[model samples]
Target: MSTGPAGHVARSTIRPHSETGVEGRKGPLRTFLSTWDGVRIDSVYEPGAVVYEESGTRSGRPGSPSGRDGLVFVVAHGFTGDADRPHVRRVARVLAGYGAVVTFSFRGHGASGGRSTVGDREVLDLAAVVDWARGLGHTRVAVVGFSMGGSVVLRYAALSRVGGGAGTGGGEVLGAGVDAVVSVSAPARWYYRGTAPMRRLHWLVTRPAGRLVGRYGLRTRIHHRDWDPVPLSPVEAVPRIAPTPLLIVHGDRDGYFPLDHPRMLAAAAGEHGELWVEPDMGHAENAAPEALLRRIGEWVVGRAG
Candidate 1:
């Protein structure tokens, strides 16, 4: 175990690219990052091919922007996913072509502490990971989130722009350092139960039986309580992310959220965001193709500067 920025402990494992799905001379640097509220988040950093360095130490000092050097893609996975999940790793691997990648499990997911508040407080997790990427010598940081994570990236970008948010780290100032944001397969509003899949998901989160299945079957731990006062929705958050390049990608055939969800977000984004209606695409990271990931990388490379 080694010490990372802000005194966080990091463990580096040297595994083959075939095993990890991360292409690098050295394997990924795994660490536990502390959120502002003190939740220990399970995180991983993979150096991209373009910026691969063999440095023994990489995390930079906090608040020292001058020390930041490259572009880093911070990935927020969909519900029930952690950094080690194959789909999440694939997304990270593809985005790494443009720059380094930082992937983390949300609170209560994977090895992360606490329980999943779904998308409400997950903004804190994304904010902390983005800050970590910036501290790792990355001058530019872009967030790419899928499904439930997609809502989080949108909220995080808005919170960063708006200064502080309620229930998101106790109104803590957050997400200020983000350069760009991408939200794929996100919903427009909260409490959406338009489709059969969503109805089933609602049961899974709201019912005792579903939470039990989530923990034992899917390896996901969910919070028993519901959102009180409700956090800002994705549509409400998009209007505030001005001048920060925002990309909203949704599949035409997404089962969880239909095309209308992306449409609502796009309309709210106005001229500040770009919308892509992927043809024949399904949903989230599990359904994203390599070509789509490459296009996203290209967009980040062009806009994140």
Candidate 2:
């Protein structure tokens, strides 16, 4: 097992990729694919391609060397966020403590390459991460997302179906494995949300350059159509993830989306899903102590089911 930054430990199977896709040998463009079999990662936050299984090791009782191997957790940060955002970093650390080596950086965020698709195009990036994880010999994998990242993660889990999501479908699944997901502060629907920084932030972004880049990429239109105000809300997409366990986490104090949204999703999930509202958690950030993180880890790692 290799250690991620900050002494994080995980199963060292998949490697980070150089580019966003097109895995192969390293070239000047290796910044886009994989140099080592497509799953070996070169960096953790930069636009990455592959990731190894992260089974973080924790320090047990002073004399005990035995420790639990953690679940592989993929964390997706919100728009304008990177793997290093204080909140993202904190989430990574929390998951790492539960035996997870988390990795995530949506398009246009962090060191990842490409323009922001808001959440649509970012779904492709999540797909790539999941593919790389499967290559590393893991059957059960879990995902955690925050804010816009939450949308991307939900979309990915849904799209992975043979046909639930529109674009590239038929993602790798363990026949039933890789069935857990958690979305924190995810908008029930992104076509438009209430009055908050979400819309303002999208309008505030400089997208002319993103448009230019999208022209060469496969799914460029997502950025242009992101705010169209017609797509199904996250609640609409919840049904697609059935059979696979889901957890919707929202902060009661969130300013971006309503706290009831997650509860609404949980209600829909019924026995296969759950919803947790942090009394003091804010938009895209969870500040709860060990109690919340522990339960979250258990839920997403397949223990809750």
Candidate 3:
């Protein structure tokens, strides 16, 4: 990556050891996400958790991607999912299998730093995590964000003409200079995320959860004034990531964002991004065929390797 106000710099990271990986070559990734039955975790940006502590192994034992680039994967959870959400953990484990260092945490869900920004300030938190991971010696980086987290990654990468540059800590604009991206049900419509039912049913459970997060001061924790979720949509972000490769996987039956979101992004990005519409999956579901995951993995390898 070019070095300037938005250049890459050295950061710190803590590495953990385990007994698993894709093809058993890259070792294992420590899963820092907590479980649903566990207590809520708090998010902190103070870098007090020891650059790279091996919090734990991802729950489901996912292997590395089919290819190898030694790039890191920063997985973001959904609107209702914390660092420990099953699906989130699954994505982490799978990316770890490919030998990529994976990370996800309870930004607002619990034990992370800062409250949820609905996707606004939380994107900065994601940038922090990416910086921390890069500090650990990762040269190439990829992002996999689900639902709301997905939108955050997209907006973070967009940077566009705002919220970029120095505010990102030493020129690291987007999550450690992402080499590739895969966003599942990333909200394309900020103004209508919750209001759109069929395309956003997965968020039906998130609406109440977001309000609960606000009760926990996530609104104040993330914003300076009034809080609104419309600021997190990817619809306007797709074209911002000019040369970066992207894989947008959307469910034909999504209940939150209209299918048009992915379609519009695809149309906007053209050859720069790939759009895949699942035939039978709902919003934020694990129903995406393994084939799609393989494509995403291959895409990362194609770009970063």
Say which candidate scores most in lDDT.
1
Of 1 and 3, the candidate ranking higher by TM-score? 1
**Relative to the true structure, how large is the alpha-carbon lDDT of every model?**
0.78, 0.55, 0.55
Q: lDDT tens string, model 2, 2-53?
A: 1112222111233343333322222222223222112322224211122223
Off by over 4 Å in 2: 1-70, 161-177, 205-232, 286-291, 302-305
lDDT of 3 by residue, 208-284 (tens): 65454444643222223344323435777777776778889898877667688888778877788888898877776
Q: What is the RMSD of candidate 3?
A: 9.6
lDDT (10s digit) by residue, model 1, range 215-246: 99888988888777587899998988887899
**What is the number of residue pairs that collide in model 2?**
23
